[model samples]
Target: MAKIAFILLCHKDPDAIIKQAQSLTAVGDYMSIHFDARANPEHYQKIRDALKDNDHVTFAAKRIKCGWGEWSLVQATLNAVEAAVDAFPRATHFYMLSGDCMAIKSAEYAHELLDRRECDYIESFDYFDSDWIKTGWKEERLIYRHWFNERTQKRRFYWMFEAQKRLGITRDIPEDIEVMIGSQWWCLRRRTIEWILDFVKRRKDVMRFFRTTWIPDETFFQTIVRHLVPAHEIESRTLTFLMFSDYGMPVTFYNDHYDLLLSQDFLFARKISPDATELRRRLGVLYSSDGQRFQISNEGRSLYKFLTEKGRIGRRFASRFWEKESSLGRERELLIIVCKKWHVAKRLLERIRQMTNIPCIEYLFNEDSCPLPDLGGIQSTMGKRHRHRRALMRMLFDYYDTDRLIVCMDPANLDLLEDFGRDRSLTRILEIECHFSDEYLIGHAMRVGLAGDRTPPETIQRLLPTVRNDMTHESDRIRDANFENFLRVREVDPTDVSARAISEFLTVPQDKAHEILSHDHLYAD
Candidate 1:
C-alpha cells in the first residue's frame, strides 16, 4: 500500500481539529500536525494530549502566524512540509489538510489514487500580462514610486516595495500568474514537494517577488511549480474547495470543509454529518467497512426491502384501476420504460404485468437501484424541478430507443415526452394521464397480450385511433401556445419511432409539413 502523510495546519478550534484527526486515525492513515504559534497554549496542549498515543503525529520546530494576503502563510506551509519530510521519509505523497476537514473516503482508496497519479497534483499556472495584480510594478518597474510618499505606514510599505525592487518585476511577475482556482488542500507526490522546496531555496529573486505580495500562500506554490514543470504535470483543478468561507475566515485547509468535497469515481464517502443521515443510510447500503477501508458490500438487504415494498404498493394500486379499464377490451403489449433507475421501472412494470401477461423491459443508469416513493405530483414549476426533468430525459434518450410506449410516471417525465410529441414520427409514444401508473402500464400491456386472439379487430382499431387522437391533441397544445410557464417544454425530433407512430396514426406527416414543426429548429438534427 502507498503511504500518504496527512499534514494538518492548525490555529484555533482544538475540539473540531481533534475530532477530524480521530476520524482519519480510525481509517489507518499517517497524520502529522503543526500548531500555529499564535494559538493559545492551553489549546495546543489539549491538541497534543489528544494525539499522545498516535505515533504518526509530530510537532513542528517553529510556528508562524498566517493571515490573509500575507507571505507568512507560505513560509508556515514550507516549514510544515520540511517537518513532514523529516518524519515520514517513506511516505509517497504529502497531503496538506486543515484542522477542520475530515476524511470522507477510506484511507485505502486515497492511497490507491495517490499511487496512480505519481505526478504532482498541485494547482499550477503560467504567468501572463493579463493577470491581476494590486501593485503598480511591471516586469521592468519593481519598486513602487509611491513608497517614499507614505509616512505613517512607511516601515511596512517600504519593506514590501524594496523587496519587489530587488526581485525585479521583469522576466514575468510570478506572483501575478493566475493559477486555476481549486481546493488549497491537496495530496502532492514527494518529488513535487522536494522540487518546490529546492526551487524556493535557489530563487531568492522569486522569493523577494512573493515577499510583498498579498495572498502569497495562494500564489507561491502555483507560480513555483508552473515554472519548474509545465502546467500539464500539475492538475489545473483541485479536488478540494477553494472559495469556502466559514465564520468570516477563508477556509484554506481541506479539513475545514470535508463534507463539501465532490464525490468522484476515485473517492468514496467515509463520513457524513447526522444531519445528512438519509444520504448516509443510502450510501451505507452500497458499501461496507473492512476494518481499515470501506468497500462495496455484497449484501443488498436494504435495497431488496425497498424494491419489494414499492413493488407491492404499485401492484395493489394498479389492480384497483385495472378492473375498471378491462371493459375496454384493450390488450396490453410489450412495454419498455426507461428511466435513471431500475427499481422504479422494475416495480412499476412488475405490478402492471402481474395484472396481465404483457412483457416488460426496464433500463436503469445506476447499478445499485434502491426503491423510492413515487413523487405524488410533478413539480416542474421550479427551475430546479425543470432541470432535473431535462437530465432524466437526456439519460432516457441516451439509453433506450423509441420502440416502446414511454409512460412517464411524473409530469416532468410527461413534459419530456411532449418534446418528442411535437414531431409524431418518434418511435416512443408518451402517455401523461394521471392514471398512468406503473401498474396500469403493466396491466394494460398484459391485457393486450392476453387478449391477442379474443379481442375483435374493431375494438383494437377504435382503441388505437382514440389513443392516437389523444396524443395528437396533446402534441398540438405542446407545439402551439407558449406553455413555457406551465411545462418549459422543448421540441424533439419526429424521426424517433414513438413520434413517427403517433404522427402516422394521426395522419400527420413524418417530415416538417406543418408550421408548428418548423417554429424552433434549434434541436433539429
Candidate 2:
C-alpha cells in the first residue's frame, strides 16, 4: 500500500478546498494545506473547522504572503511540504497541487501506478534549448535579478531591466547547478523530495541565488531534482494535466469539460474553475469509485486539440482588428457575398462553389446556421459580437488551403464591409442590395419574428451611409446592368470561377433567374 502525501497551495474558496481534501484523504492518504497569508483569515478558519476531525489532513504552521512571479510561492510550498513530512512520516510519495486542482482518477489507481513506476514525475528541460518563453525575457529572467514584480510593477520592471542591461550588470547562478525550468507542479518519490529538502538546507548559496530569480517556483524544484536524480529515475513530464494558450495563459476547465476530462489518463487536472460545483461533484464520484484504469482516447484528445486550436485562432484573429495591418489569412483571393437574407446569400454561396470548386462558407456569423465542423466549431465571444464575427471571417480566410473562398455574409454586418473595404487588393465584395424588395421584407419578418416590425427598415436605413460612401452599390435601380461586367469592374479574373458563375447565372431567363436567386430558403452544402 502506497501512502501518498498531497500538498495543496490554496487561496480562496474554502468549500471547494474542503471537498477536495475530503476526497483525497478518504482512503488513508495524508494531505498538507497552505493558505495564502494575504487571503482572509476566515477562509483558513473555515477550512480548518471543516476538516478538524480528519487525522489525515493537516495545515501548514507558517502562512506566507504570496504573489505571482514572486519567491513567496516557493517558500510557502516548502513550508507545506515540510509540515507534511513531519506529520506523515510513512508517506511514500509527495504530490504538489493547487486548490483548483481536482483528482481526475481514483486514489487507488494513482497509488498503484506510482508504486509500480517508482520514479519522479516532473518536467525538467534546459530552458535555453526550448522556445517555452513565448513573449518575455528568457535568459534575462535568470541572469538578471528581478527586483520588481513583473505583473504589478510593469513599468518599473521594464525600466530596471533596461537600466541593468545598459549597465551590464549580471548575476551568477550558484556553481555546480544546471538551471532548469518547467511547470511548478510535480509528483516526486519520498526519497527524492527528502533529498531536495536536505540539499536546500545544506546549500544556502543556491537558495540565496534563486531568491532573486523571477518565478523561482517554476525553476527551483525542477532544477534541483534534475541535479540530484539520475536520468532514468525521472520522467520528463508531469502527472498533472495542464494546458496554456498561445499567449501563455492557463486554460481553465469548466463544468462543460467533463467528457474531455474523462477521456484523458492524467491523475489530476488543475485550474478547474472554483464555481464549477457540478464538475467537482461528478469528478469526486469518479475519484472515489472502484473503477478500472483510465484509458487514453485518441478521438477525445483530437477533439480537445481542435477545440483549443479553434479558440486560439478566434482569439488571435479578434486581437488583430484594431491594428493597421488587420488582414491575416492564406495568401489568396477572397470573394465575399453580402445580402440582407441569409437564404439568398447561401444560394449565391452554393452557386459560386459549383462553378469554382472552391470552399464556400454558408452564414459564417449566423448563430443558428452551421459553419464547417472540421475547422473546430468556431465559438463566438459574447459582447464583442462584431469583433467575433470579423475575427472568424479573417481566420477562415487564413485557415482555408485553397487560393480563394466564397463566404455568405449578411449586409447588416457592416463591420466586415468597413474592414474589407479598407483592403481591396485581394478581397472583392459582390453585394446584393435588395432591402426594399417584398421578398426581403418577408424574409426579414420570418427571421426576426416580432422584432422585425420596425427594425428591418431601420437597420437598412442605418446602412445607407456606409453603403453609399464605403461600398459600390449596384441595385435594381441600375439600368441594363451585366452581372459579369459588375464583377469585371471590381477586377475579378475573367477566367475565374466567380466570373464563370456570374456569366452562367446571367444566361438564365430574367424572371426564372430572379425566382431561383430570390427564394428565401437557405442553401445547404
Candidate 3:
C-alpha cells in the first residue's frame, strides 16, 4: 500500500489531537506531530505516551513557539512537514492539517481520493489583484515591519508608525514572486513538499524578508509555490472545508451543516471544537488508512472529480474581510443587542442556547409597544431604508461608546459587525441570519407562544419563563395557534428613532434610509 503522511500542528487540546491522529493514521501511513514549543509539558507528554507505542507515529525534533498570524505558525508547519518526510520516507502524499482538523470522509475514501490524484492540492492566489485582497488591506502589514510577539498586544503607536509609512524603508518582496494565500491546511504530493523545503533553503533572503513581515506564514510558502515549474502540477484548492460566516469567523460545524458539508465535496473539515463529537459521528465510518487499497471505481472517480471542482468559494470568500479589524478589545460589561424584530431574537436566542451554553450573549427583543430598553428596534429607527440605518449605527458607536458587547441580530446589520470585527472589546454581534435557519427560526417563533396563552407581550412577560420552558421541552405542542401577530409593530416611532436605530443596525448613511426602504417591498417579489 502507498503510505500517506499527515503533518499536524497542535497546541492545547490533547484529546482532540489523539482523536484526529487515530482517525487519519493507518497501518502503513504515518503521523508526524509538532507540538507548539510553548505547550504544557504535562499535556504534551500525555499525548506523546498515548501514541508512543504506535511505530508509525513520529514527533518533530524541532518545536517552535507558534502564535496566530505570526511567522512562528508557519515555522511550526514547516518543521512538521520536514519531520514527516524523514519518518515516512515511503509516503506518497503529504497532508498539512491542524489538530482541530477532522476527516469528513472515511480514511479509506480519503486515501482512495488522493491516490488517484494527478496534481498537488493547495490554494494559491495573487496577493494584490485578488478581489478580496485590496491595497488598503496589505499595505501596512506588507510594506512596514511588524515585530513578532508570541502574544501580540495592541501597542498604541501614534506618529512613529505613520512616519515609517511615509519613509517606506522596507525589504522589498521580489517582483517576480507572486504573493499567494489560502487556508493553512493542504494536501500535497511528496514531490511538492520536498520542493518547498528545497526552495526555502535556496531562498533564505525570502525567509528573512518574511520574518519582520506580518504573518509571513500565510504568505511565505504561498509565494514560493506559485513559482513552482509547470504550475499545472498544482491545483489552487485545499481539500479542507472551512465555512466562514459573514463576520469572517469559521462557522462551527453543526447538525445544520451536514448537507452542506456532504454535498459540497471536500475531504476534511477544519477547526472543529473538542466537543464536536456529534459532528464527527455524522461524518461517517472510520477505516484503517494503512490497509485501504487505491481502487479506481467509477463512483470513486466521480467523487474525486466532484471534490476537485467544488472548493466552497460561495460558502467562504478568498482573503477574509476586515481580518485586521477582528483582533481588538474585550467585551466585559454593558450590552448592545439588536434584533431584526422582537420574535427573531427569541428564535435565535433559543438556537444559540442549544449550541453553546455561554450565557454572555443576551438577546435584544423588539419592543412592540415602546422601543425596548437598549434593544435595537427597526421601528425605533424612523428611516425605512438601509443606508439611513447604517449611518445611524456608526454614529451611535462613535458617540455612545457604551461599555457593552453589542450583540446585533439582523442580517442587514452584518455591515455593522464589520466595524467591531476588529474590535475585540465589543461582544460579537450575534446575527440570527448567519446561523443557517431562517425557516427554522420562523418555526421557533411560531412555537414560542404555541403551548401557552395567546396573550400579548404585556401579559407574556410574567409567563415568559413558563412559555420558554414549554418551547424547549414540549416542542411539539403549539402554545399559541396564532403567530402572525407575534411580530406586530404596535407603536410607530413618532420621532425619527426608527431611522436612527435602523441606520445603527445596518451601518449605512442616515440619508440613504429612504433609498433602502424604497426597495424593501421588492424583497418579496
Candidate 4:
C-alpha cells in the first residue's frame, strides 16, 4: 500500500486550513503544516486545536516569516518537507499544497494513478525569452538586487525593477545550469525529493544564488529535479487547478464556484475562500470518510462547461491530443457499430454483409462509464454512461482505419452526433438508425440457422420453447421494434434474405411471412 505525504503551506483562516487538513486525510496519511510566522498566534492555536485529534496532521517546528515573492517562502516549504518526510519515511509520494487547497478526486483514484505511473509529477519548463512569470525567469529579478519591503512601503520597488529592465544590464545565470520555471504545486516521488535535498546541499553556489532571487520556490524544485534526472522520468504536469481572473488575480471562490471546482480531473484545487458556505457543505459530502467512488456529477460537468466558455478554466492536456486525433480516420471507408445486444448485432451484421461485401465490425458495448473521461466531451457523456464505449469507438477507428461512419448506439445522443457531423473533417462520423427488434432479429437468426446445414430442422424445432421464452424475456423496446430506421440508411443496411425465402426455408405459411416482412414500426439503432 503506497502512501503520500503532504507539505501544507498555511496562512490565515485557521478554520479553512483545518477543514483542508481533514479533507486531505482521506488521500495523504501524513501532513506537515508550515504556518506563516506572521500569522496571529490566536488563529494558529485554533488551527492546531481543530486538527489536534487528527492523527495525520503535524506542524513544522520552525516556522518562517514568509513574504510573497521572497526566499522565506521557499524556506517555510522546506521546513514542511523535512517534517513530512520524517513523519512518513515509507511514503512513496511527497506533495506540496496550500492550506486553501481541497481534493476533488477519490483517494483511491489518486493513489492508483500515482502508483501505476511511478513517475514524478512536476510542471517544469526550460525558460524561453517569451515565457511568462515576469518575476524570476526574467533577468531583472536575477541580476539586480531587491530589498525586502515593509508593509507601509507597498509598490516601493516597482520603479527599481522597471529601471533595471530598461537599463538592459543583464547578468547571465551560471553556464552549468539551465534556468527553468513552473507552477510550485507538485507531487514528487520519494527518491526525487531525497535527490533534491542532497543535490542542493552539494551545490552551495546554486543555493546562495537562489537565496537572493525573487520567488525562488517556483523555480527551485523544478530546476533541481530536471537537472538530476532523465526528462522521461518526469510527468511535467501538476494535478491541481488554480483559477485566475481577467487581470490575473486569483478568484476567491464562493458558493457559485462549488460545482466548477470538482469537474476537473485534478486531485486538488487551490485558493478557495474560507467563507464559501455552500461550497463547504458540498465538499463535506464529496470528501466524506465513507469513501465513495467520487465521480464528477452532472451538475459539475455543466458548470465546467460554463466556466470553460467564459474562460474561467484553462484548456486541459487532453485538448491537445484530441486536436491531433481529429484529423485522423478521414481516409477510412468502412463503418463500425458497438451495439447493446450481441444477438441483434449479429443479425445487423448479416444484413450489412448482404448489402455489400464491405466489412462492418460489431462490438458488444458495455454499460459502464469511463474511469477517466476524455476531454473530448463526447466520451464523458452523462445520460447513458456511454463514455467507455465512446472511447472504444475512437480506439476502434484508430485500429480498424475503417472510418466511413461510426453509428452511435444511443439515439438519445443525437445532438452530440450532430455536433460531430458539423465538423467537415468528421463527415464520415454519423448517427445510424436500424429498425430491427430483438424478437425479429432472433427469428431471423433462427431462420438462417434452420436453413444452414449446421442446424437440422429437428434441432431448431426442439429448441422452440427456449427460443420463445428468450424472446419473451427481452425488454419492451427490443420486442416491440418495427424496423423503420433500416430503410433510412438502406444503402449500408442491405436487404437480408427475403421474408418469402426465410418463410419457405423455415416452412412458415406465405401470408404470415408477408405480415412479418411488411412490419412498419421502427427503433433507432
Candidate 5:
C-alpha cells in the first residue's frame, strides 16, 4: 500500500477543514492538521472531535496566526510537516493541502500517477521577469523594497527579506540563474521532504530570514527544493488554482469553457467550492472517485457504454473534414519557429533552410493576413482583436509537444520561452549567430535563446550591447535607475573593456554613451 500524507493549516474554517479531511479519510489517506494560533481552544477541540474517529489524523504542537502576506501560515505549515514526519515515518509521499482544497480524483489513482512519474509534484517557483514587479497590481512595493534592503541587515531581517523578495517573482533577476515560484500546496516524495527538512536545518541564514517575512511558507519550500533538486525533477505545472481569484464569477469548473483546469494533464486544483453542486452535476460524467480507484463515475460509464453501443452512429457523427489525424509522427525534435509577420517568418525560414534541411514548423499570430504562401504546413490565426499577442504566443507554445525543439526568431520571444523552459522534456535551442538589424530587440531574443538549449556565456555578453542601447530610450527614470541598480548588484564594471565594446556597438553615438554613462541621475536610486 502506498502511504500518502496530507498536511493542512486551518484558521477559522474548521467545518471546511473537517469536510476536506473527511473526504480524505473516506479515500483512506493519512492526514495532519495545524490549527492557526488564533483559533479558540474550544474551536480547536471541536475540530479535533470532528476528526476523532479517524485514527490517521494528528495535530501539530505549534499553532500560528495566519494572515495574507504574512509568513505565519508558512511557519505553521513547516511546523506541521515536522509533526507529520514524526507521526508517519513510513509514508512515501507528503501532500501540502489547504482547508479549502478538494480532491477531484481518488487518492489511489493519484498515488499510481505519482509512483509512475517518480516526480516531486511541486510548481517550479522562481523569479519571473522584473516587468512583473513593475506591473504587479499587488501592494508589494514597500515589502519588496524593505526585503531587498534587509539583505545587509541583521540575519533575521535578512532572511525575511530574502523570502519576500523571492516569492511570486517571475523575472528581472540576474539572467544566468533560473528561479521558480512554487505553490504553497504541493505533494512531495518522502526522500524529497526529508532532503528539504535536513537542508533547512543546516541553512540557519535562510531560516532566520523567514523570521521576519510574511508568507514564507510558499517561498521556503520552493527555494529549498530548487537548491537541492535538479530543475528537471520539478513539475512546472501546478495541480491547484491557488494563484487565480475566486470572485464568484460565472466560471465553470467542469464545462467546455472551463476545460483548461479540468483537462487530464493537471494533478491538483485549489480552492474548490464547498458548494460545487453545478460542478458535481457537470463532471459526474467524466470522473468518479471510489474509495481506492478514481475511475469513470456511473454517469460517465453509462455515457461511454451508450456511445460504444452506438458505434457506427457515433463514428459517423464524429467524422469531420477538419479533423485530420492529430498525430505529428514519431516525436522528432520540433523547432517552433515563432514569427509575428510573414516576411519575418520567411526570413527565419530562409535562414533555417540555409543552415539545416530539417522540416520547420512556423507559428504566426497575424489575424488579417496569412503569411505563408503554400508551405504545405498548418496555420492558425488568433481571432481576438486586441493585443492578445502575449496570450496568443503562450497558447501556441502550450500546445507544443515536449518531444520537439523550439527556436524563436526574436529575443523578445523569450517572454514566452521561459514558460516552455520550465518543462523538462522540451529542448529550447537558439540560433544566436543570426543578427537582426534592430539590436535593441536582442534582449528579447536572448531571453528566448536562453529558454532553449544552453547558449555560451559569451553569446549573452555579446547581446548586452543591444540590451544597454535599448535601455537608453526608456523615458522612465525610475526604470532606468532600477536597470542600472541591477547591473551594480551584479557587480559588472562599466569601465571594463567588454563594457566599452558594448558601448561602441550601440547605434547611439559615442557621445550619447558617455552622456548616458556619466549621467548621475541614471544611477540614482
Candidate 6:
C-alpha cells in the first residue's frame, strides 16, 4: 500500500497545470497545487474550475506572493504540503514538484520504485564542503538576513547587502541544526514530512531566522530533513532530473527533447518549455498510461555531462571565433606541432599517433576542409577557418574528454604562432620542425604548395630565428642528438622523438603509459 501526494507550486498556464495534475493523480494518490498570489486571478480561477471535478485534486488554503531568493516561495510550498497532507491521509510519501514539471513515467512506476525504498530521495549536501553554488555569496546566504526581494528589487537587495557588509552585520544559524543546501524539489516519506512540519511549528525562532534569509526554499527543508533524519536513511539525489546552465539558469526541455526525456530513468523533469505542445501532450499521455517498463538508457545523463563538463577553456574556446574575442584560460596541457608543410605535419601526426595514444588533429588551421569525421558538413571557408580551428580545439578538450590535445599548426600564421609562444600564462609544449638544412627546406617547400602556399627557403630561415626568440622567454630548451628527436623548441636545433622522451613528456603513471603504449599500432612499423 504505497501512495504519493504531489505538492505543486504553480504561477501560470492553467491549461498546462491542469493537464499535469490529471497526469499525476491516481486512485490512491493525491495532488495539491499552490497558485502564486501575484498571478492573474482569472488564471487561478480557471485552473480551480478545471480541476474541481477531480476527487484527488485540491488547491492550497492560501496564496503567497512568491519571489526568487525570498522566504515567500517556501511559505507557498508549505501551504500546499499542508493541504495535500490533510486531503490525503493515507499518503505514505510526499513529493514536491514545480508548475513546469511533468511526469515522464506512469505514477504507478514511481510508486513501485518508492515502495521498495525506505530512504528519502533528496539532494542534500554540506553547505561548505560541496561546490554546489555556482555564483553569489555562499556562506553569506546563511549568515546574512535579506529583507528585499532579490529578483524584483535588485537595487535595494544589493544596497542592503553592501550596507550589511560595511557595518559587519551577521546572523547565526541555529546551533541545534546543521545547515544544508539542495534542489527545491524532493520526495520525502510521509513521516519525514510530519517531522519537518512539527519541527517548524515548535521552532518559531528558526522560522523567523529563515524568514529573511536568501533563497530559503532551497535550504529550509534541506537543513531540517538532514538534521532530523538519520544520514543512512537519506539519499543525496533527487528523483527529478534537474540541470542548470553555466549562468545558473535551469535548462528547459523542448519538443525536440521528447525522445530524450523518455530515455531517462528519472520519474519527472522540470522547467519544460511552455511552447512545447507536442512534448507536453506526449508526456501527459505517458504519465497516465500503464505501459511496459522502459529500459534505463542514461542518454540524458550523457547529454548532461556533455553540456556541463566543457571546462573553462573548452567552453570559451568553442565560442571564441563565432562569438567574441576573449582570453582563454588554459586548464590542461596543450601540444602544438608547427610545420611549414602539410605533408611533414601529416607524417609527424601519424608517427605521434602510433607512439602515444594521446589524440592528435591534423591540419587544424588549414585553409581547406579538416580531416575530422565528427565535424559534419561545416565547410572550412577561408573566412571561417579560425572558427573551425577553435571548434576542433573544443572537440579535443571537451568532446574527446582528454587532458592533453595535440594539433598541427601552420607556421604561415606567424601572428597566431607568436601569440601561443609569448602567452606565458599557458602551459604548452611547442614542437617545431628544426631540420632547417637547404635540401630538407627545398623538399618540404615544394610539397607545401600542394597543401596551401609555397614557402621559400629564405622566408622560413628568417622566421625561424624570430619564432625561437619569441618562444625562449619562459620555457626551457632540451635538444636531442637526432634531428627528428624532440626539441624543446626555443633556439634549439632539429626535433625528433623516442619512447622514453615521449613517455616523459606525457608524465602519465607507469601503468597508464604501459596501457596506452601497449596497443598494436604502437608496436607496428
Backbone clash count for every predicted candidate, in the order shown? 33, 1, 39, 3, 36, 6
lDDT, residue 158, model 2: 79
Give the number of the best model, judged by lDDT: 2
Kindly report which residue stretches of model 1 are placed more than 4 angstroms away from their true locations once superposed.
Answer: 127-183, 242-288, 291-525
* Candidate 1 Cα lDDT to native: 0.47
Where does candidate 6 have its weakest 10-residue lDDT segment?
A: 474-483
TM-score against native, each model: 0.43, 0.60, 0.55, 0.53, 0.45, 0.59
- Candidate 2 lDDT, 132-160, residue by residue in tens: 56555688888888877654454577799
lDDT (Cα, tens digit) per residue for candidate 6, span 331-423: 345666655445655655665565554567777566466554333333336455564444334433543334456777765554454444443
The Cα local distance difference test for each model comes to 0.47, 0.68, 0.54, 0.58, 0.49, 0.67
Q: Which 10 consecutive residues of model 4 have the lowest summed lDDT? A: 316-325
Give me the runs in candidate 2 sitting further than 4 Å from their true place.
Answer: 298-301, 308-525
Tens digits of per-residue lDDT for model 4 on 1-525?
A: 657788888766677777777776755567889988866688889988888887788889899977666778788888888887777787888888886677766676677778888788888887565365643246556776555431212235566666667986556676788877789999998898888878778998888778867768778887888898789999887888775432233444556665566666677777554555677767754644445554564354355446555554334311211232243233333233323344444454444334332334433233333232232444344442343433334444433212343332433333343344433333332222334544455465566463344666666566665654543443223223332222122223433434444344223465544443443322323
Local distance difference test, candidate 2: 0.68
TM-score of predicted structure 4: 0.53
What lDDT tens digits, residue by residue, belong to model 5 across residues 1-525?
567788887664566667667667565567889987744577788898988888778888788765444566677877888888988877788888766555555565676777777778776544454232222333342234333222112245456556756785432322332434556777888888889889768867566555544345545677677778787788755554433211111111322212333433444555443344455444332333645333332242233335434543333212111222222222223344333223444454444333322224444433335332221123333444123433332222323211222333433344334333332223333222222344324445655463233766677667666655543332123223332111111113443432343233222345443443443332221
Cα error of candidate 6 at position 329, Å: 35
CA displacement after TM-score superposition, residue 515 of candidate 4 (Å): 99
Model 5 earns a TM-score of: 0.45
Lowest lDDT block of 10, candidate 3: 482-491
lDDT of 1 at 361: 32
What lDDT, from 0 to 1, does candidate 6 have? 0.67
